[model samples]
Target: MTTPNELRLLPWSGSGDKPCYLSTDDPDGYMSRLADSIEAIQLGTASELLEEASEALDSQGTSLDDMRCLVKELTGALRDVYRVAASRGHLLTTSDPREPTY
Candidate 1:
């Protein structure tokens, strides 16, 4: 069994909007692969949304409703990206050989 520190933070949430985790020794396991694939998709969507946001901002004709919709999508993408970053950061820290000085 893996320790709490070794648990992988899943990309999606659970009931009551709680964060989900996967505890596995195999990084190439089914769940791990699924999470990796989903993360990739999430990142790609965020990248495309960023480009769209830039274009929308550049266009003077972008309406308030359009901007609102874009903002909503950006917010969800940002949340996913943040979760991915945090999970990766934790993994790196736990796998590092050097101990923190502070």
Candidate 2:
């Protein structure tokens, strides 16, 4: 049985907006590689959205409706970025050599 710390949080969610996890010993496996690709894409999207948000904020001609739409997209991107960060953080903590394994 795979432990929680050993499970990798997938880049996407399952039904009902629940988190999905991958349990695999092979980091180079198909699923793991797919997840890595997705995470990279998500992070890239978030970075682009952040730049767009900054531009919008600095522009005096930006309309309320445009800002609202940008906010919605930003919210989704932020969620994905946060999930990636959390998954990476968990992996780090579990695999860290400095931590004494029980």
- Candidate 1 residue lDDT tens string, 19-87: 999999899999999999999999999999999999999999999999999999999999999999988
Each prediction's TM-score against the native? 0.92, 0.91
Cα lDDT computed for each candidate against the true fold: 0.93, 0.94
Name the regions of candidate 2 deviating beyond 4 angstroms.
97-102
**Model 2 residue 64 lDDT score:** 100
Q: Model 1: clashing residue pairs? A: none
Best by TM-score: 1
Q: Show the lowest summed lDDT stretch of 10 residues, model 1.
A: 93-102
| Candidate 1 displacement at residue 7 in angstroms | 0.4
Per-residue lDDT tens digits for candidate 2, residues 1-102, read 358668999999999999999999899999999999999999999999999999999999999999999999999999999999999988887776797878
- Displacement of the residue 65 alpha carbon in candidate 1, Å: 0.3
